[model samples]
Every structure is written in structure tokens, then in C-alpha cells.
Target: MPSLVTPVLPSGRLNASAQPALPIDGDLLLRPWLASDAAAVARVFEDPTIQHWHLRKADSEDEARAWIEQWRRGWESETACHWAVADVGDDRVLGRVSLQSIIMVGGQAEISYWTTPESRGKGVCSRAVARVARWALEEVGFHRLELGHSTANVASCRIAEKTGFALEGIRRRALLHTDGWHDMYLHARLHEV
Candidate 1:
């Protein structure tokens, strides 16, 4: 039986090629996570603030390495994509950006990110996210990108706005944190073409 609506993105659209490294201006790059980055990735999750917002930690370098492998699998499966935000000069890890919960049929995915403590307030997160958003919508042909964060995370809300993800509304008690249940602010951007 034929369906009435066409898939927003055809299957195999993403896994057809290897993921590419994306440049952010002259100073930053978004690249695939490498095994050597495991230690730094673990350290990033050790930050109290990161743990608070993300609700999980790497715990050990081995665990972080496992995460790196998982990211590779995500690319192969076309279910999600992750990138390490790195310094263009030396490729040192500065942060991470990802498209999660991808739905090729709907042309949608959720954006998630976090920055190293040293990179916070430096506009690294916003710049990287904006670059990824543009690539997803324009190059990858995704129709919509969504971002959601705890309402109490003012910094995250600012990032969403800066990256052109307009606030849609809030989800009541949508997520759980260490403290308790929290409301989440949802935002989204759509491809114009």
C-alpha cells in the first residue's frame, strides 16, 4: 500500500556518506570524536555545572571512550549525530553539539550541547550550534530542528535565541534533574526552503 505523504527525508540520506568536519569561523571546528579525546570528555562531564544540567557524567575515561564509540554507531545508523567542538588551531576539545532523536520521515531532530568550563561565556556554544543548525537545515535537508532545556537554565535559553531557535512554549515537568522535576522550554527552527 502506498502512503499519502512522502517522507520528509528519504531513508539512507545520512548514512550515505562519512560525516564531515565543519568549520566555525577561523577559530573553531566541529569534528568527529576521537578516542584520544576520551580523557578530556570525561573531564568535561566532571564539572558540577555540566552534571547538573546534563544529568549524567562520564565517570571514567573508559566510559567516555564507550560514548565515542556510540557516537560512531549513531552516524552509521543515521539515528543521531554528535560532534566535538574543537579549537581549529590544535583540535583541542572545547565542547560538544549534537542532533538527537532524529526522525527522517518527519525531517526533525532535537539539538543538544554543552561546553567545557573554560569555554563558557566565550560564545563557543552559540557559534558552534549556529553552524550546526545551518548545516542541518540547509545541507542535510532537515525540515525542523528543536531545542529544549530546563527553564531555569538562563544561559541555554540565551543560546537558543542567539542561534535562531524561537521559543515555542514550555513543557510542564518535562525533565528530571538532581534536585527535582523541572519544566522545560521548547524552541525550534524550520528550513525556509
Candidate 2:
């Protein structure tokens, strides 16, 4: 059996490099969320599609600031890593990509993402997910990465496949959204040994 290796930080959290900026396709960048991005974050969440799937609305800039802080805490605690997907020239927020439910000992984590209305259909989420997955597997030493989304979300399904995650299976009534229980399709990619 192959032995597992976990990255550990001095602070007792999983070692995620301090440099959070991940470049994608020259025009896009994925970096750690900042407090100043509260307004843009709130704007992205204002999309009805984002609100429906995420189940909570960040209707105000304050709420968005709190959301950013929560993810920042997640990093300190090593529970998650969230990044702002931004345009390189203007530094405008285009979306977000995250590695949530990180378990270093288990060599696993789950991926999630959302894009602003303007960014949809542009492959922003797909490229961001692919970059994050590579970083998680190569630099962070995670062996398996999982992504699950409502089966009704065809865009998310496409992003999963585009990023090299294979369809694993579906979990009936796996997630509860505002509308009702949603059947979720789970996808995954394993590190190449």
C-alpha cells in the first residue's frame, strides 16, 4: 500500500502555502478572500441561482464581510480554503472557488464554487477548479478530491467533468435547498501516484 503524507503547519493547521494567489489563463487569478471584497462578494451572492444553491443570502456588505471572515477563520483552523476568482487587470471579483471539508489525515477534501452572473458561460469556474485541484493534490498532498452538486445544476456538472473529476454516483435527496431536497451527483479525482 502507498503511504500517506500530510502537510502540517507549525500552527497545527494543515500547511497551505501563505502565497494564495493562483494564476489562471493569464487573465484570471484566484487568491485569498479579502475584507475589502465584501461589496463584490455581496454582489455575486445577489444572483438568485447562487442564493438558491448556497441556501443563505449575503444581502449586505456587512454580511459579506462576515462571510469573508468566516472563510479566513476556516483557513486558520485548516477546515477550508476559499479564494476569490478575479480578473487580473482590474482585480474585479469574478467568482469564488473553495476546497472545503479538508481532512489532512484522510487525504481528502471537497470542492465548491460559484461565479458572478457576468462570469457565467465563460469557463471561469472550470479553470479555477482545475487549478485548485492540482494545487491540493500536488502541493497540499491531498490524495482524493470530491465535488458534489445538485443534479439539477447542469453547469456545475459540466465544470466537474471539464476539470477532470469523474462522475462517482448520485446521492438521492442528499442536499436540502430552499426549494426542497435535492438529488446530488458526486464526482471525484484521485491523485496519480
Candidate 3:
């Protein structure tokens, strides 16, 4: 079937090249997940805050390694982009920031993230998110980037606002967690060209 409108971004636009490591600052950067970081990944999921908000866990090193592999494949599929926000000096994993639910035709993607307990309240997640948003909208040619969080996740709401993702509206009971359904706050940032 022929469509009137063309794809907003060309096929292979992302997978055509190696995924780039985006720099956040002198101390931090966004890099591909490594197999060696499995322990850190597993430990991060053990944090009560992370498990509660993310609603998933890597109970063992093997599970975390599998997740890392899956994230690598996601870059090839172009369906998702996941990065480990790490310290530049020691290369320690601090958190994760991702572009999920990507749609190439309309040039849109959803952003999601979680910071390690030790890194929380240090502005790490927000800064990493802001950097990723710039790369998505400016460097990658995405027209729109969205960040959605459960209404109860107030810290996530702050990250969205700090990254220039405007509060669009609330998605009633959009996400299910252990507690129950949650109303999600939808926020978006548009390419400024």
C-alpha cells in the first residue's frame, strides 16, 4: 500500500553507523553497556527505589549480562537506544538513560532512566537525560522526544522538567506496577530547527 507521507527519518539512519558515546561533561558520559558491568547493573536493580519505579530487576549477574546483550541488539534493530551513564574517570556505572519505543516514520521516541541510589540527588540523571535529548533531537534528527513518569514519581517529573520536556498531559492509569496502576505524566521536547 502506498502512503502519501514519507518516513520522517530514513531507514538505517541509526544502525548504519556505530552508536556514539555521548559526553555529558568532564566527569560523566553515556556509553554502551559492557559485560563487565553486569555486577553493577544487578546491584542497581536491587535498590528499592529503582525496583519500585522501574518495576523490573536483574536479580543476578547473568540476568544483567543478558540485559546488556539485549540493549546492544536494540541498537541494531533501531527499536531502542540504551546507554549506561558512567563516570569518565573510573568508568563506573552511575545510572542508565534510554530512548525507548522508537518510531522512525514519525521521528519520535520515549526517554526513560534510573539513577543508582548513590548517584541520586546529584543531578546525574537529569544531566544525562538533557544530553540525550539534545543528541536525539539535534544530532539524530528525531522530531520529538517524550518522557513519561508515574505521577507518584516526583523525582522523575523533575528530571523531565529540567530537560526541557514540557508537561503535555496525564495518561490516566497508563502504567502498572506492583502497587497497582499509575497515572503517568507525559512530557515532550520538540526539535528546534
Candidate 4:
């Protein structure tokens, strides 16, 4: 197991007063979430599979707007490094990857990702996850990275495994999704190798 780390971060308790520019994919030219991104983000959430993975039921633009706002707040607060991933070639928004739970002092963070349902099983998420993981470990100076996914979401589990995250253990009844309280696999990656 990787050594534990601790970096102070926001409690994720408040909304940010403003927006902050975030890093885009190196190979892909992703843009940060803008006020205009509400529609797109809503569309992603409307995908049954995506909603199932995220455990957020589909709703109208009004509901999606609230959630997107929270995501935006996370970015502006520096509590989470969130990005809206895109394809460099065509500037298509593929999905999003977040380096949340950042512990700057300890060089550690946790990662999460979700891709457009149409883009599933194409290695899109895997490549993007790996890219952000590498950036966090090397460029961002993080020494450890962690990820988790619903136990039933084999694809996400596979993504974590493919990205070099070690299966730490199961968090019993951890996620209350459409399936109710479901087990979750917690994975971690560290610079120690």
C-alpha cells in the first residue's frame, strides 16, 4: 500500500464567488466548464448509463444547472481541480476528470471521471484518466492518487485497473445509487511504485 498523505483542502462546504481557468488535456484540447456548458453537461447526465454511474437522476436544465454550478464552485475554490475533457482533433467534449481531495502539502489527491455514453468502451476515458494521473503525479507534484467506482460498474473498475490503480478494498454499502446501497471498490496509485 502507498503511504498516507494529507494536504489541507476546502471542506467542499461553500460555493465559490468566481470562476477559475483550469488545465486542459495536453493531447486533447478540453475547455473548462463555462456558463454555456450547462446544456452539454445536462446532456451527459441524461444518458442513463452515465446517470447510473454518477448516481444522479436525469432532470431538466434547471436541475443540471445547479449541479454544474457546484462543479464550477469546486474549481474556483481550488478544492478540486476539475476539467471538461475534449478531443484535440475536433474539440469534442469527451467527459470530465477531477483531481479532488487535494492535499498540496502531502502531494496527494483523489481522481474521478465520467465519459459520454456514446464514447464508452473506446479507451477514451482510460487515456484521459492516465493523462491526468500522470500530470498529477509528475507535473502537479502529487505523490499519490486514488480512485473509486461502483462495484457494479465494471468498466470504471477496468479503467482504474488499466490506469495502474491498485485495488485497495471494498467500501461496503458505500454508494446509494439507483441500485440502492452498493459496494464500491477503492483504488489507489502512488509514486512509490
Q: Candidate 1 lDDT (Cα, whole model)? A: 0.94
Sliding window of 10 residues with minimal summed lDDT for model 2: 6-15
Per-model TM-score versus the true fold: 0.98, 0.91, 0.98, 0.79
lDDT accuracy of residue 184 in candidate 4: 86
**Model 4: residues with Cα > 4 Å off, grouped in runs:** 1-27
**lDDT for each residue of candidate 1 in 60-157, tens digit (9 for 90 to 100):** 99999999999978988989999999999988999999999999889999999999999999999999999999999999899999999999999999
Kindly report the root-mean-square deviation of model 4 from the true structure over all alpha carbons: 5.4
Please report the candidate that would top lDDT against the real structure.
1
Model 2 Cα lDDT, one tens digit per residue, 1-193: 6546544322344544463789998999999999999999888888888988898888799999999999888887888889999999999999999989987677778999999999999988899999999988886667899999999999899999999999999999989999999999999999888
Summed over model 2, clashes come to 0
What is candidate 4's lDDT per residue for 67-122, written digit by digit as tens?
66777676656667777777777667778888887665666678998888777888
Candidate 3 lDDT trough over 10 residues, lowest sum? 2-11
Whole-model lDDT per candidate = 0.94, 0.88, 0.92, 0.73
TM-score of 3: 0.98
- What clash pairs does model 1 have? none
Q: Is candidate 1 or candidate 3 better by lDDT?
A: 1
RMSD of each: 0.9, 3.3, 0.9, 5.4
Which ten residues in a row are the worst by lDDT in model 1? 2-11
